[model samples]
Target: MGNSYEDECRRSLAEEQAKSLAGTNNWEHVDRERVHQDWDVLYREITPFLDGGSLPGDQQIQEFVRRHFDIVCRFYTPSREAYVGMSLFYAEDEAMRAFHDSYHPGLVEFLGAAIKVFAEQGSGFAPSAGEASA
Candidate 1:
């Protein structure tokens, strides 16, 4: 009796999540595929820069930052203000923070700074509230 209600609630939550993802670009074939590929590709581009030391405004770093910017825009289509709010969530949301931090010791902080640079200078700086993905 005690466990039945909890099980039903869990099932309901799972069903809701499935429905939500099913209707979004998040789970749709093309966008999900693109994001997965870029996830790896971007990591490759940024990892070297992360290890190389400073985020100098060289062509490569700029390009790396640009990719990040474009991906965010492509995903979130956020206005500038929404982008800042999303960045705050990325930094503060415990689950997101844990996911980012797991990548490296200081990856969360590094990405925060990098995102700032990307938004502040990149041509596609618009951010939207519902656009950002995990």
Candidate 2:
């Protein structure tokens, strides 16, 4: 059989992601396995807040959003506007929504909400540890 829908989405997203990194030296230091591990941790950590019916702006959920932001910063530093836009993309992009929801139903929406909250709060631009801001 051919790849599942989720697999196909992942493959497609990876290609798009690679293109987004073109000409950026930041990708040179990225550890794919470590980034994946961090994302797993983020998803696991955030699920409880979603399951408990916490709102996106809840203190706990916002804290997790900070972690999520740092994880994303591993690749590139996104402006507040860009970060908010990315959150929206997660919900609006069919493939992104499908990939995220494959982990947990409603996860994409929850994460998008929390990310918007984080961006709205004007969180400082702190890249992940050891990363220099561009």
Scored by CA lDDT, what does every candidate get? 0.58, 0.71
- Clashes counted in candidate 2 amount to 0
Residue pairs in clash, model 1: 76-131, 78-126, 78-127, 78-128, 79-127, 79-128
Model 2 over residues 1-134: C-alpha lDDT tens digits?
13363344344445444554785663887888998898888888777777788999999888888888888877766655556657666887899888778778989988877776787685674332234668
TM-score of 2: 0.72
Model 2 stretches astray by more than 4 angstroms: 1-20, 126-134
Q: Number of the top candidate by lDDT?
A: 2
True-structure lDDT of candidate 2: 0.71
Give candidate 1 misplaced runs (Cα > 4 Å).
Answer: 1-30, 56-59, 127-134
> In angstroms, how far off is 105's CA in candidate 2?
1.0
Listed in order, each prediction's TM-score against the native is 0.60, 0.72
Worst lDDT window (10 residues) for model 1? 5-14
**lDDT score for residue 132 of model 1:** 71
* Candidate 1: residue 22 lDDT (0-100): 63
